[model samples]
Target chain A: MDILESIKVALEGIWVNKLRSALTMLGIIIGVAAVIAVVTIGQGGRAAILSSLESMGTNLFVVYPSSRNATTPITRQDLITLEDVEAIKNIVPTVKAVAPTSYLSIMTQVGRQKEKTTIICTGQDYKSIRNLELVEGRYFTSEENNSRRRVAVINEELAKTYFSGESALGKQVYLMNTPFIVIGVVKNDPSNALGFGGDPPKEATIPFHTGETLFRNLRIQIEGQTYSKEEVQETIDQIVKLLHKRHRNEGKYRGYSLDQEVATANKILGIIALIIGSIAGISLLVGGIGVMNIMLVSVTERTREIGIRMALGARRRDILVQFLIEAVVICLVGGTIGTILGTGGALAVALIAKWPPLITPGTIFIAFFFSASIGIFFGIYPANKAAKLDPIEALRYE
Target chain B: MIKISNLTKVYRTGAISVTALKGINLEVAKGSMVAIMGPSGSGKSTMMNILGCLDRATSGSYIIDGVDVSTLQEKELAKIRNHKIGFVFQTFNLLPRLTALKNVELPMIYAGIPSKERRERALKALDKVGLADRIHHRPNELSGGQRQRVAIARALVNNPAIILADEPTGNLDTRSGEEIMDIFQQLNQEEGVTIIIVTHEREIADHTRRIVHFRDGVIIKDEEVLTPISARTTLAALPPAGEV
Candidate 1:
């Protein structure tokens, strides 16, 4: 029989038992759906990492004071200071700006609203280096930072939470009972999950001098952005050489950035996708078994019909083709439906998570063929069984 | 035309063997109407199976038309069966889901006939069976006699050398049975299509020109009927039934 003719017959058989065929195809549908959802999520995760890095700063890196031994995680001597930031600026031509940062956690009271928040102490260049966008008011000036002014710049979350929609500019909020006026409110950062660089800190920003005046024992963390990504190596080398000369502690400082964080995160996300995909693969295998079970039942149910065809001069190969085609048709139908539904679900999830879902044509094809091959792999045994039955006995079957 | 020599069929179950057809020899002339009659398990059905190429003989040669189909490979036997023989089973055996035209086109499909020609030929065959208006009806929608007629149309669609029927009228009423027999006789005498029927009823066997009687697994009597009964003339003498 012609392959098309056999396909026609197979379609008729599937149509005759609509509910059974649909139930049999359910496994493939869910299996393929999971695959598509995972791939789309993986693509979204990679994109999120890239965009998060870009939003934090342009061509940026962070310098950490590395501990030389296992016992001393952070010693008194292993701390980046303001001197290191100044030295790197004078040493490297590509150096844009360096913000020597220090963290201070304290309780703040604004009228009836009182909460604990961290305070960031950095230079006037912190505005440019960290790309801090102003939603209201303005950042502290060089004179205010030099003279140690008691002024502050709060983020959107801190301003909204403490101020309760009240105007934050010129308002006084006490940190550890020391009243400091709110100078500005910065825009909310959406990529806070990446940690320091992209996080919208619930804190105030004061000048380098005022921070020194407030805290006696200071441990500074210096971060800088460069002219471009290509100048990263030169900037790091110059900073390393400068720190070595200033403190005579060679290899004491380690370089990091949102870029490195992204690379690590992407590697982790790739593995995550694979793990989830493998779990989904198991579901697909189970679905294939369902197809096989249903096909075996169908073969047995149609044994007498097979005998009639055989007696009408159908070859064994013809019977094999018929059943195999039936199996494949079922899988393809389920695959097509699953692909559409999966893509839709991926888009919905991406929208909810505020991430862009990327679905390549190649991945779609891979998923489609994967399900089709599953049908073939599971279908062969039953088709072979149907083909091998003795026509005389089959005809005699009641 | 068929020629059989020392035909034998032994079925094995584990270590035990039972001979279904025991060393029987028979010959059937082309365009002749013949019947093989016996009780159940008398080997008449076994002989029909071998003749239809549904089973292979154990130690014998059976030639159909000009080819020695006994020595043919399984695939070759299938091809010969497709081209040289047609089958009609007792239960009507019409696929209940398919319309009469589609059922008739089945054998031609196996024979690789094109769709347009298959449709044309299937329609012609259904018309020959006097179900031209009911070509689109599924088997369940048709009566037992009409179902048998559909099966006959399916058999005739391929235009094979011989039509082999196993109790074709066994499931029908006497009038419907007579109608089925009438059609077979018309195909034999008018179209000169060789017909072989396997039946146990002596009256049904008497309608054919030749009857081969089987006792146990061997043929006991093979004789030509001097005057064969005419199913068409008998039906004509009775009251006219509704249009089939």
Candidate 2:
């Protein structure tokens, strides 16, 4: 018989046993649904992270001393210092901004409020590079930093606790027995700073030279930016070369860009998506087995029908094709329904989470093909059984 | 035309063996109407199945037209059945899900006839069986006589050379049975198609030109009737249908 005839018969068979066919398809529905939802949602999360990293600035890069593998342990003298930062700024023409970090950990007091916090000391360029806006006074000048003036900038946590709704600018706060005047307050943004970047720090910022002069022992963190994101690599190479020259060719520094971090983050997320997709695929295997089970039962139940068709001059292959087509129709229908449900669920979740769910056509195709293969692979045994039956015996079957 | 020589069939079930048809030789001429009469387990139905190519013989040479069908493969045998043989069962073996027209079109479909020609031929066959108005009726919606007529239409659609019917009137009332017999007689006479009927009723067998009687896997008698009963005449004398 023709393929169209077999398909018609198969469809009719499914329609006759609609409830049973639907029940048999449940496993496939769940399997395809899970794969669709997980992959789309995972893609959404990856996209969200990439955009956030993009907003933070793709031009951003970092360098740290390659301390662990060095032939000799790095000392304070071997670490990045203020002289190295100044030399890099002067030598690397591609460099747009440079900030040398030096910190003094101490307890600070403003009126009756006292808190133990580190005082971050850096240059005026730190404000522009950090993309921070001042809510109160201005940052310290280059001359004030050179003169080692005892001035500071504070975050909102300090302002809320110490000032108690009063203006904190121009107030005196003592750190490590030294009195410092508050100059600027950075605006607090809690929404965008989520996960891993936990609660904002309750700290103050002082001039680099002022903190360096006050504390004999200070840990330094050097941050810099390039003219553009594309110039990051050139600027980094120049920084390492300048640092090597200043530190007598120790070559103990390392640099990274935020773009690289984004790539690594996406790679990790992709692996996680693959792992979850595989876990969901296990249910598909079980679902295929269910199809096989139902197909076998259907074959046994339709023995007499098989006999009739055979007597009507149907070949073994015709009977086989009919049964196989029936199984495939069930799975394909189930897969279609599952795809709709999964896409709807992903969109619903994305709406709630305020992120776009990314579903590619490739993902849908893979899922549909997988469901079809599941049907064919599992349907073969039962179809073969039906095809091999003796027509005389089948006819005699009550 | 059919020729059978030493035709035998043995069925095996694990350690048990049952011989359904003993050694037999028979010849049937083209365009002849014959009836096989026998009681239960008399091998008449077995012979009919072998004639219909539904089962293979253990040892024999059965030739149809010019081909040696006993040596043919399962696929070749199915093709032969599709092209040349038609069957009408006592229960009127019409597919329950199909309309009468679709049922008639079934064998042609298996024969690979195009859908348009199949439809045209099926309609013609149904009209020949006087069921043109009932083409859309399903088997369950048909009376026993009408169901049998649909089966006959199905059998005739492929324009098969031989029609094999097993107890064709076993499930019908007297008038319906007589009506069906008349239709078979009309088909054999007008179409010149060879007809083989398997039945236990001597009254039904008497209508055919030849009667072959079987007993316990063997034919006990094979004889020709000098004057065959004309069922159409008997049907004409009976009261109109649907009467108690």
Candidate 3:
């Protein structure tokens, strides 16, 4: 019989035993669904991280103090201060902006509400360096940062929590019992940071010099933005060397861009996704075995039918093709359903996790073809068994 | 036309042997109707199986329409079965899932006929068997007589060289049996189709023009009926269908 006729016959057989066929296909459905969802979610996460990294600016670099040996402790002289920031701004022409930041996690109070918030003390250049967006009011000026003004810029989360109904601008937010006027409300950029479970903590920004009196033994984080990506490593080298020259310590400072870290993380993520996706594929193998088992049962059940077809002049190849087509139809149908469900599941997860769902056509194509191949691989034994039956004995079968 | 010379079939199971057909010689002319009748273990079924190309003979030169089928491989045997022979089983053997029309189209499907032509020829064959109105009914939905007629349509749709019926009316009532015989006789007389019937019932065998009796795997008697009983006359004499 022709392929079309064989497919029709297969479909008819499946239709007659709809419940049995569906039960047999359950394994494949789960297998394909898991593979698709896991792979898609993994890709989506990687894409989100990469996009966030790009949003942070590829030319941006961070320089922090690092003790080369465990035996040597970092002294106050090695800390990044206004002088080092000045030297980088004046000496490094490649550097666009140099912003020094200090982080202090402390309790803050606004009206009757009290919450723990990370206060980031930095210069006005931090707005451009970190690519932060101010939704309301303006950032504090350089004069305010240099004169130790107690003005602060709060993230959207803090503004929403403490000042939900009213504007946060010009509000008195007390940090460690010291009052700082809210100068601006910056939009919360989740991509700015990674690996925060559930929701990130509330954050507020204050002037750089204003944190000196409040913080002791402060380890400052220096952020620099360059005009282009090509000058990032050279500019980092220049700043690190400048710090080393002033501190009289060769390896007292470390500098790197986010691009290198992102690449390494991407490689690791890809490997991890592959490993997890392959683990999911083991179920597909089991599903293939289930298909084979059902096909075997089907062949035995239809022995009489095979005999009748043979008597009607069906070649052995025709019988084989008929059963093989039935097996493939089951798997392909299951695979199509699984693909849709998996993509939908991945989208649901992406919605909750706040990331885009990334599913490629190639992944779907491979999945479909893989399922069909499973059918063929698992179908051969049963089909061959049916094809080789003695027409006499088969006709005699009850 | 078929010619069998020294046809023999041996069955071996774990050193035990049983010869189903032993040195049997038979000849059947084209467009002739014949019946092979015997008791159980008389080898009539074995002869029918060999003649239908459903089984290979152990030792014989069985020729059908100038082709030496005894030495043919399974593939060539299948081709001959598809093109030159049709079979009607005692149980009807129609695919339960198929309607009468689709069942009739089965042989033609194996013959690689196109769908449109297969449908047209299947309709014609069903009409010839007087089952055109019941073509949409499945086998279970059909009466015993109607189901037999559908089987006949399926056997005839491919227009093979010979139509083989093994106990064609074994499961039917007297009236349905006679009606089935009437269609066979009509087809044989009008279209000159070669037909072979395997039946143990003497009454059924009387409707054919020739009878071959088998005993102990051998043909004991082969004779031509001087005045063959016409199934049409028998069916007409019986009570009208659905009254008995």
Candidate 4:
């Protein structure tokens, strides 16, 4: 029989037992759906993170004191100080801007609104080093950092959460009970998830000297930016060398570019996605087994029909092709439905998570190929069994 | 035409074996109607299966239309069956999901006929069996007599050398049986089709031109009827029944 003819026959068979066919296809549906959903969500998350990392800074690297092993510990003397920052600015021609910053999670309050929030204590150049945009007011000036003025710049998220409808500029907000006036409000950065968890954090920034006075024993980190992307590594090397020389600790400082960190993060995310996807693939294998089981039952149920076809001069190959086509049709239909459902599921997740879903045509093609392979792999035994039946015995079957 | 010499069939069950047909010799001419009648387990069905190329003989030579079917491989036998033989079952084994027209087209499909020609020939065959109006009806929707007629249409759609009917009228009422016998006789006398019917009923065998009686895996009697009964006349004389 022609392939089209066999397909027609298979469709008729499926249509005749609609509920059974649906139940049989449910396994494949769920298997493919899970696989597609995982892949799409993983890709979307990776894209979101990478894009946010890109927006964080350009040609940026962080230089900090390394905690060398216990055999050669890093002392307080090795910490990156304001003098080291000045030395890098003066000595490194590749360096464009540098900011000495400290991150502290503390309780802050504006009138009745009180919450625990992150405080970014940095120099005036923090804005240029981090590419921070100001939605309202302005960043603290060099005068504020030099004189240890009690002033703060709040992010848009903190503005919305703490101040409500009131503008946060020139308002008084307390950090660890030390009152500081809000000098500016910077735009909320979605890429803040790198420091915090996935949720963007509410942040208030203060002058570096003011932070040193307010909180003692601060571990300072020097964030620097290069003139261009190509100069990032060289610039970081110069900055680290300057710090080592100033601190008199030869191997006590490490500098890494933001791009390198992001690459490592991407690798880790890829491994995680692969692990989850393979776990989902186990369901597809189980689904294939389900197809095989149903096909065997169908072959047994249609023994007399097989006999009739054989008596009508159907070759064994024809019989085999018929059943194989039936199985493949079932899986392909299930796979198509799964692609639709999985895409829908990924979109729903992306909607809730505020990320764009990344579903490529290659993902869909791989899904199709896998489902077809499962059908063929599982379909062979039963179809071959049907083909090998003795026509006389099958005809006599009740 | 078919020629059989020293044909035998042995069925094995584990280590035990039962001989079904022993040294049977038979000949059937083209365009002739014949009936093989026997009691249950008398090997008539075995002989029919062998003749239809559904089974191979153990130690015999059976030639159909100049081809030695007994020596043919599975694929070759299937091809010969597709081109040269057709079958009708006792239970009217039409695929339940298909319409009568699709059922008729089954053999032609295996014969690799194109769709348009397959449909055209299937319609013509259904019309020949007086089931043109019911071609769209599934097997369950047709009466026993109409179902048998659909089977006959399927048998003749491929234009095979011979039509094998295994108790074709066994499941039908007497009137329906007469109607089926009428179609068979018409196809035989009018179309010059070779037909063989396997039945135990003496009355059904009397309608054919020749009858071969089997007893204990051997043909005991082979005789030609001087005057064969006419199924059309028999059907016409019966009381009128519901539309089928």
- How much is the lDDT of residue A131 in candidate 2? 67
Which prediction has more favorable DockQ, 3 or 4? Answer: 4
* 2 versus 4: better TM-score goes to: 4
Docking class of 2: medium
lDDT tens readout by residue for model 1, A49-135 = 668767876467777777652344655665777767777778778888888888789878887678788888888888887787999
| Sort order, lDDT high to low | 4, 3, 1, 2
- All candidates' lDDT scores? 0.86, 0.84, 0.90, 0.90
Ranking by DockQ: 1, 4, 3, 2
lDDT per residue (tens digit) for residues A215-278 in model 2: 8756666677777989988777777767767787465777877778778877888898899988
Per-residue error for A171 in candidate 3, Å, reads 3.0
The prediction achieving the highest DockQ against the true structure is 1
- Cα shift from native, residue B167, model 3 (Å): 1.5
lDDT of 4 by residue, B10-33 (tens): 999999999999999999999999
Q: CA lDDT of A76 in candidate 1? A: 63
Weakest ten-residue segment in model 1 chain B by summed lDDT: B235-244
Candidate 4 ranges beyond 4 A from true positions: A194-199, A351-353, B242-244
True contacts kept of each: 0.72, 0.46, 0.78, 0.82
lDDT of 2 by residue, B56-117 (tens): 88999899887889999999888888888888888787778789998898888788888899
Predict model 3's lDDT versus the native. 0.90
Give per-residue CA lDDT, model 3, range B73-174, as digits (tens).
999999999999989889999999999999999988888889999999999999999888888999999988889899998998888899999999999998
How many residue pairs clash in model 4?
Answer: 0
